[model samples]
Structure formats: structure tokens, C-alpha cells
Target: MTTTVPRTANSADTRGWSRWAAALILPIGPAAVAVLRYVLPYDTVDDSATMVSKVVAAPGRMSLVLWLGFIAVLTLVPAAYSVGRVTRQRAPRLTMVALLLLIPGYLSLGWLTAEDQFLWSGAKAGMDAGAITRLADAMHPSAAVAGVFFVLGHVLGTILLGIALWRTRVVARWAALAVIVSQPIHFIAAVIIANHPLDLFGWGLQAVGFAAVGWAILKLPNDKWA
Candidate 1:
């Protein structure tokens, strides 16, 4: 016998909002981050002063990325919640672990972006290159370690999330596969292509993954899953 669970009025309302939030945030967040990367100066992992100079050269444009990118990352909270709900039945444990990894991954990225503004201000103030170099060198160790963890969290979280969604059959399997593949592709592309506008292709793959998840969420009927 098949027993169907009934959704309450409040539950229905929450699901509706969650679906909409997922639909909007999933695509928008990655799109914003990709656009920012395309518009900003090419990124170099080791060149702090050069980065600061680029941003300080056009503080206004940098501010657009700084603020908008932060907002886009914040949207990950809702996106995570939606994912948890989607994978609750078949892969609850995996989803939980993925969320744990994702929180710190996004946080490290966000903190670094905010920290860059401080560097920008120093550059704008005509600080001596020697002083800036000393500061950058001093910060390098901790930053490098955090950067490693950031990459680990993102790659691991992506794999776990994709596997969970795929195993549960809650979303399209191809979409889950895309989400899994996008991470490593983005990293390799960033390395090989370095700082070209073509990097958008790598980032766009991430957006496609998110868009697929969002579409999957939207396709769920009101009474489908809690």
C-alpha cells in the first residue's frame, strides 16, 4: 500500500517560498560572481600589491564586485536549505555534510573579498610599496592555508551534493553530474586560461549547475516532498 503524506497550509507556504528562493538565488548568485570576475582585473594568487593596485585604480568598479559578490554569496544560505530539503530522504547525511563544508568555503571566499578592500584603501592612500610588501608577506602564510581549505571545501562539498542529489533521484541526474564536474573544470580552466575573459566559460558551467537544481526544485509539485 502506498501512503501519501499530506502537507499542511504552513508547510505549503514555506515550500513555495523555498522553491522561489532557490529558483532566483541559484542562477543569480553564480551569474553575479562570474560577471564580477569577468569585469575585474585578472586574479593572481600571489600578487597582493598588484591586485591592490588594480582595484585601487578603479575603486568604483571594484566596489561593484565587492558588494554584489558578497550579496550573491549570502544567497547560498537559502540555496543550501533548499538542497537539504530536496535530499532529505535518500541522502540526508551527505546533504548535511555538504552544507557543513559549503558554509566555511563560502565564508573564506567572502572574508578574502572583504579583506581586499582594506588592501585597496592602503594602495589608494599612497602607502609605500615596501610597507605594503611587508604586510602582504606577513599575511601570506595564513591566507595560503585558508585558500587551501577553501578549495577543499568547495570541491568536496560539490561532489557530495551532486552525489546526494543523484542517488536520491530528486533532481535530474545530468544536472547533478554537471554540478560535480563544474568544480574541477572551473579550477583547471582558471589555471590554464589564467586571467582571460574566457574564464567566464568555466564559471558559467557553475551557473548552469545551479540553474538545473533550481529548475528541479520548481518542478516539484506542492504535495511532492516536505
Candidate 2:
């Protein structure tokens, strides 16, 4: 015989708020990032000198973009965890692997944001663009490792999570396909084609997928949230 454990009032309340928070944040973070990316004149092919020059040229706008990215990064884990939770019942192993990769991947944003901050600070101090580039190139080994982790983990994790979502039928199949394809599009746009508009479109697809997932989460009853 199996025994059922009762949930406490506090536990239920926590689940309710957590679910709502995750649902709200899931789409908002990616959508905000997508719009901010479009607002910023970002070119993937830009060298460090060019990058520093752009930042210095529009410090106020660059600062705003950086802070918005930082805020979006803060929301990543909760949003990702909620997605993982939805897949856990049908695709437990895939969910676990995705979460393992995503958690550290999202956490590594600290290193990335620090690098951006360093660039902004150097530019603010009237440092030469080349000098700022040199300093950025000399970032510590740990930071480099974090950068690698951030790139690989988020890209691969999202792909796996999308596959899990597809298999589980948790969200719309097209939405799951959007999530799976989004990162590849991002990589191609950012690295191969070096097209800012394409990059924005890729992120827009991510926002679309996340919005679908968030809607599904919101539809769940509070008792089932946990």
C-alpha cells in the first residue's frame, strides 16, 4: 500500500506563487532581450576595437542594453526550471540533462556581463579602443571557461529541452520546433551570416516558443504546479 503525504498551506502557497512567477517570466525575459537586441546596433563580425568603439560612441544606450541583458539573465534559471518541470514526467532523463546543462549555462552569464562591464568602464575612462580590446582578451582562464560553458550549455541544452518538449507534447509542436531551431538560427546568424536582423529573428522564435510554454503553465491548476 502507498501512503499520500498532505501538502501544507505554506507549501501550497509557495507552489502557486512560484508557478505564476515562472509563467510570467518565461516569455517576458526572452521577449525583452529580443527587442533590446534589435534596439542595439550589434554586429557579430565586429572586432574588439569596433565593439569598444560602438560602446563608447553610445555609452548611455549600451549601458541600458547591458543592464537589460543582466536582468533577463537573472530570470533564465527559473524560466528554464519551469520548462524542465513540465517535461519531467514524460522525459525525465532528457529534462535532467537539459537542466544540468542549462543551470550552469545561465549562471555563467555573470562572467559574460562582467566582460561587457569591463568594456563599458574602459570606454568610459577614455581608454583607447585597442587598449580595451587587449584588456578584454586577457580575461582570466576561469572566465574563458565560463564563456565556453555558457555557449555550449545553453545552445545544446535548449535543443535537448525542445526535443523533450516535442516528445512529451506539452506545448504546441510548432512551438517545440521553434525552440529546437532557434539556437541553430542564432548561431548561423551570429557566426556564419553575421546578420543582425537574422539574429533578432532567431531570438524572436525563442520568445515565441517560451510564450507558448508559459501559457501552458498558467493553465495548470495550483495544486498541480508542484
Candidate 3:
């Protein structure tokens, strides 16, 4: 007779952890980004919130805040990825890669945000950097490029994630619906914001993406199911 070891029915652990993580991730990432912009801006980075004019005004202070936002974006990546994985559809490898890519793209986008904030701050400081140059000529076209990349990542990865969610039976159907709705909104916002890096609404849309992911994670059955 062979004795077989069965998988533990401890999905509770993963569920608890994910729920808490979702809660923390929800606040940490976006809030940190918000703080950096307000507290760090030496020039009141309102108008040109995406330029060197701001950075030049208060190098250390503003840079710290900008970089902190950068970090917050990075921190959100894993939580989002975990939500996708919990879905258990298919192509986790690809999903994982996309998740990893999101982190840097997120940072780049924040860097772009920092630039926008910086410019606005510069304007307030009365530094007079002149008319906003063509956004194309700015630092890296990442403000535009990364936005598209983020959409692609969500589209491709989420398709697989939807499948996985269907398979794992972890997340509720409500979560699936929320996750699905989030991508298209993000895509449209990305397209609109590509040329206008200073727009905070689009950033709020991306934040919506995070909030939905957190809800989905809360809905999951946890890893013990595997």
C-alpha cells in the first residue's frame, strides 16, 4: 500500500495574506505618489508638472518625492501580478513577464509624472522656462510609449488572467467583472494621456486599475487550492 500526501486545505492563509496585501497595496502605491508630488515640489509643480524646470528648482526635495512615487508604482506591481495569478487561467509565464514589465513602465510613467510636476513647479517658482516644448522632444517618449505598453500588458496578460481566473475558481465573478472593466478604461485613458502627461485624471484611471486588482485579490480563494 502506498501512502499519498494530500494538499492541505489551507487556502485560508493565502486568502488572509492577499486580502491584507490588497488593502495595503491599494493605499501605499497611489498615496505615496501623491505625497511626493505635494510635499516635494519646491516650485508648486502645478502647470508644468512634467519638466526639468521643476527638478532644477528643488533638486533634493522634489527628487525625493518623485522617486518615492516611482517606488510606489513599483510596489504595486507584485500585488497586481498576484491577482492575475490567482485567476489561474493560463500563460502565467507570459503574465508574470508582463507584470515585471509593468513595474518599470510604471516607474517611467511616474518619472514622466515627475517631469510634468517639475515643470509646473518651475512655472510657480517664476523660473520662466518658456513655452512647453513639444512633448515628443521631452526626456524619453516614455510618457507616451509607456502608457501604450501598460495597456498592452494589461490586455495580453489579462486575457490569460481571465482564463486562469476561470480555471482557479478563486476569485468571485464580481472580481472578474471588475478586472475586465478596468482594462478598457485604462486603454482609453492611456491614449488620451499619451500627449498630455500632466493630466491627473488618466493617472486616476490607472489607479482605478489598482483598486480593481485589489478587490479581485480579496475575492480569490488563495494559493492552497493549487
Could you estimate the TM-score for every candidate? 0.80, 0.89, 0.52
How do these models rank on TM-score, best leading? 2, 1, 3
Considering TM-score, which of the candidate structures 2 and 3 is the better prediction for this target?
2
Clashing pairs in 2: none
Instruction: Report the candidate with higher lDDT, 1 versus 3.
Output: 1
Winning candidate number (lDDT):
2
Better of 2 and 3 by lDDT: 2
Q: On residues 50-132, what C-alpha lDDT tens digit does candidate 3 reach at each position?
A: 43454556566655665676677676566555555544355466456656555555545554555545455554565645543
Tens digit of per-residue lDDT, candidate 2, span 25-140: 89766666666566664465687778888887888877877877787788888888989988998899999999899889888977877877888799789998889989877888
Q: Lowest-lDDT window of 10 residues in candidate 2?
A: 35-44
Global CA lDDT computed for model 3: 0.51
Quote model 2's TM-score: 0.89
Best by TM-score: 2
Error of 2 at 147 (Å): 1.7
Candidate 1 lDDT by residue in tens digits, 139-159? 756677667766787778877
Q: Ranking under lDDT, best-scoring first?
A: 2, 1, 3
